[model samples]
Target chain A: MRKNGVNMIKISAKNVDVFYGKKQALFNINLDIEENQVTALIGPSGCGKSTFLRCLNRMNDVIDICKVQGEIVINDFNINDKGCDVVRLREKIGMVFQKPNPFPKTLYENISYGPTIHGMAQSKQEMDEIVETSLKKAALWEEVKDRLHEPGTGLSGGQQQRLCIARAISVQPEVILMDEPCSALDPIATAQIEELIDELKKEHTIIIVTHSMAQAARVSQRTGFFHLGELIEHGSTDKIFKNPDNIKTQDYITGRFG
Target chain B: MSEAPHTVKSYEEELKNLNSNIIKMGGFCEEALGKAVQAITMRNSDHAESVIKDDEKIDKFETLIEQQVVNLIALRQPMAIDLRETVTALKISSDLERIGDLAKNISKRTLLLNENLPKNLVDALVRVSSDVQKQLKSILDAYLDRSSSVAMNVWESDEKTDDLTNLCMQEVIKYLKENEKNLDDGTHLLFVTKNIERIGDHTTNVAEQVYYLVTGKYLEGDRPKGTEPIVTGEK
Candidate 1:
């Protein structure tokens, strides 16, 4: 539902915190992400941005010592609830990582794996269509359509990242969490991925965590700045880059301090 | 927010250089206006020639400031207050350069005047010039202090200069129609009055930039303007 204005709130986190044994990684963070818009999370290293991102789809649960607190609500249900099916919740939320990682299987297999496991296709022809459409959506179709049988890891770093992105979209997820997706690529490859992100936001709600303030300013409609395990500021990207309210945010973005 | 130095010392030095260059150019503009006024009121062609000759320094400062601004944007990729600071430096320098050019134009017209003028006409012109100089000085102070309130004060004071300019224009027109011999000096006086009025306008533009640099929002609504001289529609 719409909370502040015209944009619908896709995900709302209220007083969310994360702890790894004795150390608290994140303090109370309250942020509402809008649908079909890119939300960027930026801060210095070890600021809990990645931890906060992992909490969205219970990715943090895989860590034996990590404990998460508070409500992460999407559409009227809390994804953090004990009754929530993590596998089902993960199916609705896809993730891309900092490094370009593609499975050891063939390129075609990489795109089909998620759908095959999720039972999204009923026949061979349906699976092939899903593979083709996912590759095209990832903007890697023309480069790899003729070599779908080749190992996914055999591709270039940029192409492999796109392949991973293709794999993520194969399940038709509603939200995409990218953690420094372009950090390992060259400038040209980074630009291509940034363009893909702009196009992807038309169909998916995107939340990106990056140390590059320029990237956050370029791609995000909204930006949140985290510092010392606390969310220091969050607002429109323009406002954050132009005139952020908090002193810590201004200093961080302007390179005065971390 | 606490004023902290940038992590990279070089970037901080570059920004400091830009600010100093702007202040230097502002000083030159103020000096040019002062000299131009002295030339006109005291009938000193030497002072007028010096003001015109020194216009090139102001122009060079504009070029230097613009180059630094471009380099900052390309290399530093400044954000937030730094971005606004760079942009306003470019804008304020351009306005200051225009002020220098206007002051030079007034000095150029001074060289063309040979006939003696009445004391009241010269006094009115001096009043306009003095008000514009005060406005320019206040804007420069506001810029250095990063004070929006000071800039707002300068912005609201433009009407005073405009009123004085209008009065000077009327005096020149009356002097011209009073006698055929007074036409040449009176015509030159009219141009000088216009140049001084334009300098006042450029100062107001600098005031607006200072306001925007200090606070990200533009000064809201229409700028307060003074009444214009009435025009005769038809014979």
Candidate 2:
């Protein structure tokens, strides 16, 4: 992490490793994520990219045998410390996953749920305002404003993904983690979500794990290539795709080898 | 790092095909230039006709290579060296095509020189022709070897070709001034020398492409050059 007299890093991971019982999934890794920029993680399957993403918000804690050893510092405090509150940590770091698993609730309820639980809105009028603002930010307000009471599952796959994004931003998380969020959608829908991501990065730091190299190239400023449990290379997206420093990364991105 | 084969076998084949096509096209340019020189020096109109006819083959090669390059880009979406090589193939093919055309043009100009030229003027023009051919051969070799240093050497050697052209031009102008009947042969010889000089220029363009393909950077600064002789009859 380089300050160089300015605080550009939003998250810094040092010597981060993860293990699932007797099987080690991630090696020692260090990366500094810049503020308000989209950093993409790319690799073949079983390369530990998603594992690294989960480690950011301590999502791996749910796995009974999973253990993470890391000094993942955010804003100069190590979040891996025992004193760190997992709930509060999650509140500050929102996530949208591979599937749009919005709860079986109304559209309005979906957006209002997080803020309500966190006491973000004090009155009915404020909750309505939060719902409208979040939906508008997600670019879904125009399509879903008339159907606020409809089930979130009733929307199209792309619309539901946007609803998930709206829910993520309703609580105003500083960092958003997206794990293959566009894999399940059609090209048109994917482009919609991609456009929304371009809009979202203005207000949040986003880390995305993707298998699509073209998507990674189009959407990210910085890209990291992972291989066989190791971070092989990380640099500007242009260099990674055009002239990477590491052969493994070059091979992977250029489809010479996995 | 050791080179690894692409996972898709056909993609590897396409790239290899593109490479071989470029080399083949370069060979045609060389053959055409050889015949052009033969036509001029031997004063053989038959050789001039053959050189002009063979140029069609070179044009067909350019078309084939362009198609291959386009398919490779659209399908493989090659990156890094692959991308550079693909782009260089397109550019080098164009330059080689022009070389073939210039060679054909030289042969065409040779057909008009019915009057016998001075031995010294013919010798000087042939010298310029051979020098430009040497530059062309070295640049093609640089492309084949993927050697930036060799490409740089070829790039720097263009000055010699230009200097030879200037001397050859001065000789042809002097021969033209010696007799009014020498004007037709002398002017045709002058155009021939200019065509060869233009071929040297195109070869340098290929050298720049080769350097960029190997090193991912264009050569810095202007290319070395020699003074050009002023033409009196053209004005």
Candidate 3:
């Protein structure tokens, strides 16, 4: 495991590959994700960034035909171990999808969903406190505090996305994995989520899969570029965007061809 | 650092155009300095007038090159080596324009010295001018070839022009003291010598930009500066 000062490796993947029956989706991918920092995965469409991200919390196990092969260890626990509890693994490694998928429930119920399942709170008062604190952490408490009984789907696209984030953090996960969390939002909404990601990294290790290079550059400290289902290069954000060593990375970042 | 060509052909063409314009500006400044030095040595008012007129073209070159750089940044949004190349082009264009101005300033005094000349002082000025011209030409080649060592050679030898100018200023002062009747001519020669030294400085400026362009950082250590007085031979 690589260590940098006070930061430690929260997740590390080696020789990770994904496949769907006859077709391979990722090939020999390896990377390290530091604790309480943002690591962004960026590439063109169908480049397997999303496929690789699903390996973090064993999200690919849900698909009958999809097979993930690799060692994805989070805090010394192998996520792909045969007997590893998938529900418990997902709780510690929360995921936010490309679309803002808030459950068709009340706003308070959506934030309270994970804590209820995990028995994080004992009484009604404790559940109310968990909901309030999670919303505050997601920066949506002040906006949606008045109408806690309203449907989560009734909120705006940006607000619904924030509510989903609040739901993810309600479980108090150690790592939050996001897949194009702002693709459906407008520019203003995108900026808001980008800022939230930066803030979220203070408490949770975040891995984001984004199609927007600027978004990756803006939000993450370390950036990994993917091409043709292979992890091409990864480094600090400035070096990757300003002076990447690989030719493909240079072409993609400079807009020569992507 | 061998790499394949860019996939977008038109962006490559725009970058090539920017490079060609920098080389074109370099050629204009070189010719202008050559003309200024020749006009002073041969005492030809016509050559000095042409050098002065050429300054206008150099100024226009800087304007056009600046526009090209801005457009490339806005349209193509270059990164890595291309970004460094465009930024250094902007800096080199500025230095070349300043060199053209110094050459133009020298030619203005060459016109003033169309009267009875100081032959010995002009000879010393010619020696110093030739040194600066050599440095300028070498740096232009270094920039075009993307050779940091060649640019470093020019950057290191900049003090030679300053030392040569210092010696020539002494000769001019002595000639002025010995032949009191040619005081005004000797004074113009002193200004011409200082202007040549300034041109030497601008070439070094362009050399620094070339170093940064190739390596993506400033050259290690401080740049050697001219310590000799502007027009006096004082330490």
lDDT of 3 by residue, B174-193 (tens): 87777677687778877888
Q: What is the Cα-based lDDT of residue A165 in candidate 3?
A: 96
Identify the leading candidate in terms of lDDT: 1
Ranking by TM-score: 1, 2, 3
Error of 2 at B53 (Å): 1.3
Model 2 iRMS (Å) reads 1.9
Cα lDDT tens digits for candidate 2, B115-205: 4678898899888988888888888888888888989998998999888998898888888899898888887888899999999999999
**Model 3 Cα shift for residue B78 (angstroms):** 2.7
lDDT rank order: 1, 2, 3
| Candidate whose DockQ is highest | 1
Candidate 2: the clashing residue pairs are none
Q: Each model's TM-score, in the order given?
A: 0.97, 0.93, 0.89
TM-score for model 1? 0.97
lDDT of each: 0.91, 0.90, 0.88
Q: Tell me which residue pairs clash in candidate 3.
A: none
Candidate 3 local lDDT, residue B134 = 97
Candidate 1 docking class: medium
Candidate 3 CAPRI assessment class: acceptable
Q: After superposition, how far is residue A131 of candidate 3 from its true place, in Å?
A: 2.2
Indicate the worst ten consecutive residues by lDDT in candidate 2 chain B.
Answer: B226-235
Off by over 4 Å in 2: A1-7, B228-235
Indicate which candidate wins on TM-score. Answer: 1
Query: Distance from true position, residue B175, model 3, in Å?
Result: 3.5
